[model samples]
Target: MRPITAIGFDADDTLWQNEQYYRLTEQSFVDLLGEFAEGAHITERLLEAEKRNLAYYGFGIKGFTLSMIETAIEITGGQVSTDTIAEILEIGRNLLRHPVEKLPHVEETLEALNGEYLLVLITKGDLFDQERKLAQSGLGDFFDAVEIVSDKNATTYRRIFSKLADGPERAMMVGNSLKSDIVPAIAAGSYGVFIPHALTWVVEHVEPPTDAPRFRQIEHLGQLGSVIEAIKAA
Candidate 1:
């Protein structure tokens, strides 16, 4: 692996606790609709709705809330009450108000690499929601740039790198999702670093590519500094 001058980090599960909120809200959703169907059935249907609505609503709490309401309507055959719908909206609002909890070593790792590299936060989700999280995270000042993109793809990665002096060949992407963060950045000629998170959303998943030319996997964010050191040495 070659040295990277610019490093992009994915937000959400990579830096802070995010998906756990979704999971918790989902459980609440199931309980709210307990009279309509079983928790397992509601969960399965909600997942399906979320996947189906991805294109329309994009990603984040707003979309998830809509999907939950849709699923409630579908499963209950329109028997879902207005009060339940209001409760679903409240659930979403509660998610947006959820406190940002930085994962282990997030602040320390960022501090370690603070002035050593050009750090950019490349995350995809609702613009307002992402901005809110960043503001709440207290790690915003560590980043040289912040990009809240509509999607993360090879073309998107290339586009982001194109504006940088070092370009994609001298950049690296670190994130939890194999499909969004790892594969696309690797395909775009940057080193892709995968930091697996246990509570990743199902829709963000894909098998890690077997033939990725420049890829690294570390157990935790605390190991990122060492990984970068090894890359520089290589």
Candidate 2:
């Protein structure tokens, strides 16, 4: 119920077409590795590699490319061909080159809230890739500040909110990932707004904190304004 002084947003699936592209790339990876392993097995192994490599590679297409290569190598017992590796690399490049498509109502919502509140983009991923996506998004100017951090945690939200706005208590975080954007921001004493994306990555999946006073879930970005108003009146 604290006056919302600033708002933080998660960029990936929340703002534009991200997870869907990743899903397509993942299917491409499976197809590329089909000769060495079954599609299901390949997908399972690649997911395992991705999860294991998160600490080493963090997040983004580059890490995903590396994980796919590692999975290929592991599946083939180190006999995977160089050409396949090159193809996998190309898949990552394609992901990087994919045009940014802003979701429905995203521009309108940002335009509506741009001057009314401090809008900060707080997303986590490879800095270059994140920056590239933001630049391509064309929604970059709407944000007052941007924080591309290594991870999202309670501490991360607290630090960002304290420095960029009044504090976490006076800020709200809106994103698709309950794990990365909602839980941590709420834990940091900020309102956590969940905007569901159809193709959210499995790794980011988690139960919603339905009992939390600061937690809210909306069908899409279009419903965000009503949620904000309700939050204000709460």
Candidate 3:
């Protein structure tokens, strides 16, 4: 393996348990839905609605709020009263105040890795929400550059990577989501290191390729230091 000149990181689960926060808010939405409409049907409708809304709103708070509204209307056949909509909006607003509880050893590990690699933060979601989390987490300073991407597909990664000063060959992407991070990073001619998160959404999965040389796997962010050291040694 070539010595890595720079390293890129995926935000969210890679650095902290982001989806769990979303999941908590989602449960709140589901509970609210039960009062006005079909019970667990909230989950079903939101999933279906987000499948389409993802194109327009991408991922993040705004998109999620829209999904909540759309799901309510879809499940209720437009009979969802204003009261239900108000409750949903209130729940979404409450999420803005959601606490950010980080994964274990994240801060210490990032501190250890910062000086050794040109670290960049690459994440995809609503800019405001992502930025809010980044700011609140106090982890932004560890990265040399911050990229809040609109999507994490192969094409998007390819385009963003080509714009980097180091180029893909000398860069490695370390992240949690196989679909959004590893697969796309590998496709972009970069080395990809997968860090499996404890909690993951179904949408963030990808079938691993049988013949990929540039992909590696680790259990968590703390394991990344060894991979970096090995790359440097080689």
Candidate 4:
């Protein structure tokens, strides 16, 4: 291993808790739709609408909010009231407030590596919500570059690296999701370090590759410092 020149990070569960909020909102949506709309129809309709909207608008709150609205209309036979729409919009609006609840040791580990490496934030999501989370996180100044991408597949990451950094060898991605964060980065000729989170979404988990060449796993975000150190000394 050589000295790490560029260190990219995955947001959401890596730096802060995100999925739980979505889960809570989803449960609320289900309960509300059942009470006002058709029986148990909103969940299926919302998922389908979200999938279609992701194709058009990509992953983010705008698409999600639209999908939520579309699902409500479908379930209610276009009878959803303005009050109901306002309530749903309110939930989407609150999604942007990160509330500063962070993953364990994310701050200390980022502080440890900021000066030594070219710290960058490489995250994906809705523009408004992702930006709000970054603004709330006081750690934003430590990063030299920030990328809010549409997805974390290998192709997307390759394009991001092409535009942002010079070489893959010196770039290592530190993240929580094995699928979206680790697998794609490693596939793009960069190293990846995986830090498992307790409530990883099913969409973000992948099977461990049998032949991953340069992948590292850590118990928590605090261990990232040691991983970088070991990589540096190698």
Candidate 5:
């Protein structure tokens, strides 16, 4: 029941559009390899490649692009042509260059809470891509700090909260992913707020910690103020 002081936000799909582009590119990937396998099989293999390559490539468009190529090679039994590989690379480049579209209520919510709380952007992705997206979003200045990390975990939340605020007890982490944004933050002793997005990566999906006292779910960023107030009152 500690009063929330610092607020951590997730960038992809939380503040703006991200996963939709990935989904689109993934469909493109599936189509490019349609000769080798069915769309569902291609998609499944791509997901497997992505999961296997996480430790190798981490996250973001670069990893996704590589996974597409890997899946192509796997599906085609190493007979996939270089032309298809080039096309997959172009798909990734397009993803990197896609426009950053802010979600509704993102700016107003940040503007409303900016000076009142220590607002930090804690996200997981390729460092360069994340930086580019943040700069392009034009929402960078609203944050007191920006953390583009390799992954999100309880230890990561604990370190960030302790370094940026009055520790995890006074911090609240908000985002769409139950796995990265909510459970870990709650485990770190911070208030965890869920703001669901229409498209979330399969890897990021997990069961919500509804029974956790520090866990909360809001319809959107616009409702965040009320949740904060409720937490404060509690």
Candidate 6:
């Protein structure tokens, strides 16, 4: 394993309690549409709507809000009421205003690695919302840069690492999603560290790439220092 000179951190679940807020908003959507369908059915439809709208609206609370409205209309056969629509919009607004809760050891781990290696925050979402969370996180000073991208893919990782380090071989990406964070980074020739989250969004789900040469999995952010040390020792 080549020693990692630059490290990229995925902002959402890797650094803070992101998915849980989305999950709470999802439950709120189900409750709002309880009259039209069961909670499980509503949840399923919402996920479908989110996936369907991903390309058109991209990701974030705004897209999610629009999808919920669309799902409500579809579930109720276009007869969904104005008041319900208003409530759903309120749910989204509340989510936007929700407090950011940094996960365990996030600050400590980042502090440990700061200045020793290049640190960049690579997160994909609505720019405004992501920026808001970063400001709220108060860990902004630790990162050498912040990238709020439209997507995460092999090409994107390669481009980012090219500028951030000597090469992809000297870069490492740590995040919760295998599809977005691990597999693509590994494919781009960077090391990928998987830190699983209990409530990952379905859209981000993929089997861990245990066979990948550049892949590593740690249970949480608290273990990140050890992973970095192991990579450095190699």
Instruction: Give the alpha carbon lDDT tens digit for every residue of 117-202 in model 5.
Output: 99999999989999999999999999999999999999999999998899998999999999999999999999999999889988
> TM-score of every model?
0.97, 0.97, 0.92, 0.88, 0.98, 0.97
lDDT of 1 by residue, 1-234 (tens): 346888999999999999999999999999999988899999999999999999999888888999999999999998889999999999989998999999999999999888888899999988898999999999999999998888899998998877853889999999999989999999999999999999988887899876776988999999998888887887
Question: Over 4 Å off in model 6, which ranges?
Answer: none
Where is model 3 more than 4 Å wrong at Cα? 35-38
What digit string (tens of lDDT, one per residue) describes model 6 on residues 6-54? 9999999889889899989999889888888899999989899999999
**1 or 3, greater by TM-score:** 1
Q: For candidate 4, lDDT tens digit of each residue in 40-135?
A: 567667878887788887877778888899888988889989998998998877776638578888888888887777788999887768888888
TM-score of 3: 0.92
Cα-based lDDT at residue 223, candidate 1? 95
Model 2: worst 10 consecutive residues (lDDT sum)? 1-10
lDDT of 3 at 189: 82
Q: Which of the predicted structures, 1 or 2, would earn the higher TM-score when compared with the native? A: 2
Q: For this target, which candidate reaches the highest lDDT against the unseen true structure?
A: 5
The TM-score between candidate 6 and the true structure equals: 0.97
Model 5 off-target regions past 4 Å? none
Instruction: Write model 2 residue lDDT over 104-218, tens digit each, in one string.
Output: 8999999999989999999998898889989988999999999999899999999999999999999999999999999999999999999998888999999999999999999
Q: Among these predicted structures, which one has the highest TM-score?
A: 5
RMSD of each: 1.4, 1.1, 2.0, 2.4, 1.1, 1.3
Could you give candidate 3's per-residue lDDT for residues 90-160 as a string of tens digits? 88877677766777778988898787777888998878877888899999899888999888877766666
Candidate 1, pairs of clashing residues? none
